[model samples]
Target: MSKGPIAVIVLSHRDSEQVTRLIHRITEGTNSFAVIHHDPSGEPLSIPPSSQVAVIPDPIPCKWGRLSLVQAQWKTLQWVARNVPEFSWALLVSGQDYPIRKMSAIEQELAGSPYDAYLRYFRVGPDPAEDVIPWQALTRRRYLYKRRVPFSRRSVTLPFKRRHPYRNGVELYVGDMWFNLSAPTVAAVLDARQMSERMLSYLRFAPIPDETFIASMTLNVHPAPNVAHDSKRYIKWGRRQLHPQIITAEHLPDLRASDAFFARKIDRLAHPEIPDLLDRLAEERTASSG
Candidate 1:
């Protein structure tokens, strides 16, 4: 198979026990392995010393909806690009994410495909950021200038605004933070990001830079036709909510119906049965296909 062992990058902060379990579960089969970047502000991870998953020795401090999160992910990707160069495809996901489809199925899909990356990329340029894409309104709010209030963690969107910043004034793209990319494509993006001085500066104050950084860099360097516009993740956004709704057993029907390989925002404390249900469904599907 052209696609060999999968490299999974896990960005986690809370729930040490669950995070360690997630690492073991993802790396248990198909020779896949995970490297984790745990935010220092949260509880320290407790992965076993003998575990297959690698931990970043000095993880960068991460803040929600800030450039720090993007930087953390970039550092993690840098490690994978250097160490796991033999990976067929690399998946960017959070520790809370759980696979809905069987690992074998995901590998088969990656091996037979020729796409450089799998992600959601929609242009946000040439005009104002209103209705430029399906998710334009929310996206515009994310890219606009903002300032953190003094003595508090809160930040407010400033009235001053300009187009998304780039050194070359090229069109920028925005999409989900999670992505799947081939080995070569991952290298290309890492290079592009390293060379982006202006964009990096702008992102230092931008809200949720991770959602926009990787997509813009990937689409700029890679041919659009060879890139799939889907991240293949099942995430449920709640009305007027800051984060995605927690996945539970009630979401099983939708998860089973979708072609998504993984689902997110799983709170193990609240929905202990969700993972078991996913395992059962994966086995049933594999059995039926066989």
Candidate 2:
């Protein structure tokens, strides 16, 4: 089957080596494009030849893990949209993510399909208490009880002046942040800056703008039929924690049954099964296609 060019945008803080390795694996036998957004303060490293690496200027004095990282990701996406022509779909992979399916299988599944897989859930009018606030507040406590931490003292806040109260009986659904977006969706997000000053203004204060912004905009602009409500990425939440628990060999059964295109929070140092798992998944995809 013929395939349109796919753009893989890797979001990383200091893991250039890991990102490079993933790019190598992804482009092994296909005409794929890759862009790495290396945080300015990350360790110095060389990007392999034939790949595009954009390093954010150092000393930007931005938090490595918060909304700043999301901003960096948006910038990288904008760059890809402008520089890479004929790009059909954009895959947003983190430094810690590993593919559980072969690129061939993924391409075949997505061939000529306009739907993009992203984590989406339904929420009633009374949005979840946490969702209303920016992500930084929930994750980093950037804004707590009207007081800001030293690092977040001057940080921009989300547009919501006051937190919306959620009624006790209302149900809320929240899920993963990672997503695979179509070119048009990507373009729409990039264009959000131009269309809505309110959104662009909210970027600074909206702690985890990355998670909320795209999902909110997509829900508002795109038709419901075009959006993949659930992204096929395997993620396990830790004990009362926000981030997904690390993936280990013990989770292999669930991963296999997940029908997920990728899995995250892999322990590269401790979990040696990762590479083996990827290999097995690739073989499975090959056999299925043949």
Candidate 3:
């Protein structure tokens, strides 16, 4: 049976070159459409000619940790919905991320499944008690530095005062930022009324709004039988930290067992293991299919 088309959206700030490289690697032999959301960094971008690229106009005098990134994502989603025809699934990815599985295997698994792979939540609330430290809450604060406008202390206040989707006294769990979503779920997210307000509010104060927006919105609109509980991307958290540790070749065995389509936070310069990891995944996929 012929597999359906998949649209991969890669989000990045100033890493156009890395985004292009990832596009080349992941879409090498697949029927996939790629959209790269260039963060409003004031530099020229080198986009691949083979892939579709959308340069989101950076808002002048942009502030860090603002809603611009989320806006860019929304724009990219609209672009895909309008321009890309016949896509069955949409995979949200990052420029810093790489695929750990072969295209064929990912296609095979997705083709046979009706579910979307993403974290979901019904409500928003305080972050878990354990997640309040500098490592968890302050890592992305770098983005908030060097703002054109003076930082407002009030703006830094907590974004989620309460857990999301708080219906029937059930506290909803937030999903990961990265997700593989079905087309229908994507449509629902774009159409949701709370997307703009909640996302914008969350972006201002939340250390990582990307992790929560889709998860909460998806659950609120389309409660799953369709959503996948776990993200299929392999991420390794650093020692006593919230963010994924930088990935390297030594992680190949773990990647293989992860059953994940992609892995993140790859170090492009010093990581010699990337090529080997990709080759092994391709070989194993071929062997499995044969």
Candidate 4:
């Protein structure tokens, strides 16, 4: 497989040290660059200076379950497009995510793959297939009237019906927020976004917009863009869970067997031993490959 340069974009709200470690691991022996986007609302991340890593000076104030999350990703994508044109692929990872395989191996796997984007996706709304996000989620975000207390931390929503965002034959597609995207795919989505304010407004009001925005841009377009139903990240989404299962030492065996490039949602404060084990695994993998 012919290797090409890759740019790893790390979106972090906390855990600066871990993010730096991740950058070091990726840049140790590979032709790759790291772009760190830290949310300004979180604790200030003290990322060590590195020739291979660039941190965004003005980070977005990302909010949970809001359009701000998608805004942060938009900023990161724009930064990569303007600053790292040499990279053929852009991989988005969170601070909690750590690589499971050697950088060389990841590059080799991507080099031979046919898909332009490695992301999990499914159609949503109007009698969607199984596993797709139900229409209720979309309705709650877009159609229902939500009322919030001025100072209290409580809100209420009233059920209602309004126009679905998908207009003029445009279909809604939802997927995992993390993705590994090719240059062409990124360019296409950004270009379309710049040209369409209606699409932007529609997605901004949609529920969990981060999960739907990019998927809609690429998958809904004509000629159906090249996409693969895999993110190459080991994430366990348990039943009725709002987020992925937190990774711990108990999951090490499954992580090793996954053959994924990275695993997600790790928190050192909650599971201190897990990161140590993962660090050991990374070291062993790198040494063996070397």
Candidate 5:
């Protein structure tokens, strides 16, 4: 295993202060560092200089539910892998994510994990015999032909009629985009087969391609390596609109008990105490470990 630090790729489009704080939180007590990909058109960011953090210059302009988001993330990761030699692992998280556990322990767990990846990846198909979930409308909407009704606000997905079912020969997979990838799995994703011309061609017009691109690419390998379906993240999308429920102080009990290493969609400005509570939890872990 590589003895290098964990690399955290952060997609920050807003709230520079919160993003800056998040970078420090993830790297404060661990060797892990952060690469911030702030949107080129978003709010200007001012973060303190640190050896543990670097910001990608001119982050691609990303539109939600568009291919640009996926492209920016993939390119940022590739750049990091080439620049930061032998990183033990790399994880993708948003600027809104905060560690629910100690960063050092989180890094240790990933560094020692047997699984090559920790993300929610499952095949989407109608065949039950293949251990795939029933075909989902959302899946169809994402993969099938869709025209973006641009010039609104964020990219909107009004999928065209099922028309030609987008299928890559039973290899279609879907999952949340956030994930942690070991060095080998990272290399596998970077392989020519995974980042192929065909895959890019298909994803160019697909809705929310970022959610499917990495999962479809990484999980389609033959003799797939052990992959934990758990993303080790706590995010609640319970019957809400587009945005997830913002974590509040009331969620402390759940946060304390969850196995998740990180939680997202948290507004630190709104729930400032949340971080202090998490910091206490980390201290409690340290105390217990001691």
Candidate 6:
């Protein structure tokens, strides 16, 4: 879209092959740079070398629902800001994510878009608030007693309750962690993190802080266009479920019809046909563009 290269930051703690396929799909026919933040303690990453792809040198030991998850994402943004400044947009995808549309089409659209970010966010608790289960979870800092190592196979969450920590004026916004951000927005977010020690310290114990960290930071920048609060990722979060549903071939028709640039929770082992289907769809989009 912008005729400029895009940076793809992938945070993965799962299978390396899936991560590799995700990287390949993103790099196929687009001018992009990809950086993978592999979980240092998870399955080893073994993707073949390509100039467009880089695995974070000091991979964070990412733990689910822990501050480490947010740190890993931050580290990726820091890497991009310092090393890949030429790119205008940074699309955050997970290892199990796959391109729904052609990479070229995504590039062309983003290149032309006026918005600084493509993400969705809402205040965690409004006075006449939009009520959701995560509302209470986010506003209250429960992790102090309930925290557990996110990626640890044997880790267990210790349950406890505490009063909500007072936020004098700090606001918490929640949204999907994955997003597409313009370079300026990315830089702004990084800068905010560096400057906001109080906010960071507060969120460190906040439940699922990854969902709130970047989404909340976007609110700090000016010009509404710069905070385009729409994260164009296709994920189905079922009620009471800790994770989104894994994508399968049954969603093929929906995947083709939707405008989302990418879809997530696709496990190659569970639905091996899905990657090929996405590949074919990507090729079709590329052909049509040509």
The numbered model that scores best in TM-score is 1
Ranking by TM-score: 1, 5, 4, 6, 2, 3
Q: Tens-digit lDDT track for model 1 on 1-290?
A: 35578888899998887787777667766767888898888887788875568888799988777788888878888888788778777898898998877777877788888787899778775456345545666566667656555445666888886545643645578888999988888877777654456677777766567888888878777444378989999999987787998988888888878888788878888878877887787787778778
Please write out the lDDT profile of model 6 over residues 145-228, one tens digit for every residue: 344343443333455543333255446567788988887788777776443555567566555668767776776544434666
Query: For candidate 4, what is the lDDT?
Result: 0.74
What does the lDDT read for residue 11 in candidate 4?
Answer: 85
Badly placed stretches (over 4 Å) of model 1 are 128-134, 144-164, 167-169, 193-195, 222-225
lDDT of 5: 0.76
TM-score of each: 0.89, 0.77, 0.75, 0.85, 0.88, 0.85
* Clash count in backbone of candidate 3: 10
Give model 2's TM-score versus the native structure. 0.77
lDDT per residue for candidate 4 within 142-250, as digits (tens), equals: 3334433333434456465445556577776777789888877787777775334555665555545677777777776555568888888999888888789999887
Model 3 ranges with Cα > 4 A deviation? 1-4, 14-17, 42-44, 51-66, 120-172, 194-199, 223-225
**lDDT per residue, candidate 2, 1-290, as tens digits?**
12566777776655556666676666753546666666556665577677444443332323633556556656666777887756777777777787787776666676666575455544323333635435323533332222223456345444455342112331222334566777767777666564334443544454444555455555555344277777778878776775788888788888767777778877666675676777686677678769
Report the Cα lDDT for candidate 2: 0.59
In model 4, state the lDDT of residue 258: 81
Local distance difference test, each candidate: 0.77, 0.59, 0.62, 0.74, 0.76, 0.74
> What's the count of clashing pairs in each model shown?
0, 4, 10, 0, 0, 14
Worst 10 residues of 3 by lDDT: 141-150
| Model 5 lDDT per residue over 131-187, tens place | 544434457545663544445433345535533323545367788789888877787
Who is ahead in lDDT, 1 or 5? 1
Runs off by more than 4 Å, candidate 2? 1-3, 51-65, 114-117, 127-175, 194-196, 222-225
Selected candidate, larger lDDT, 1 vs 4: 1
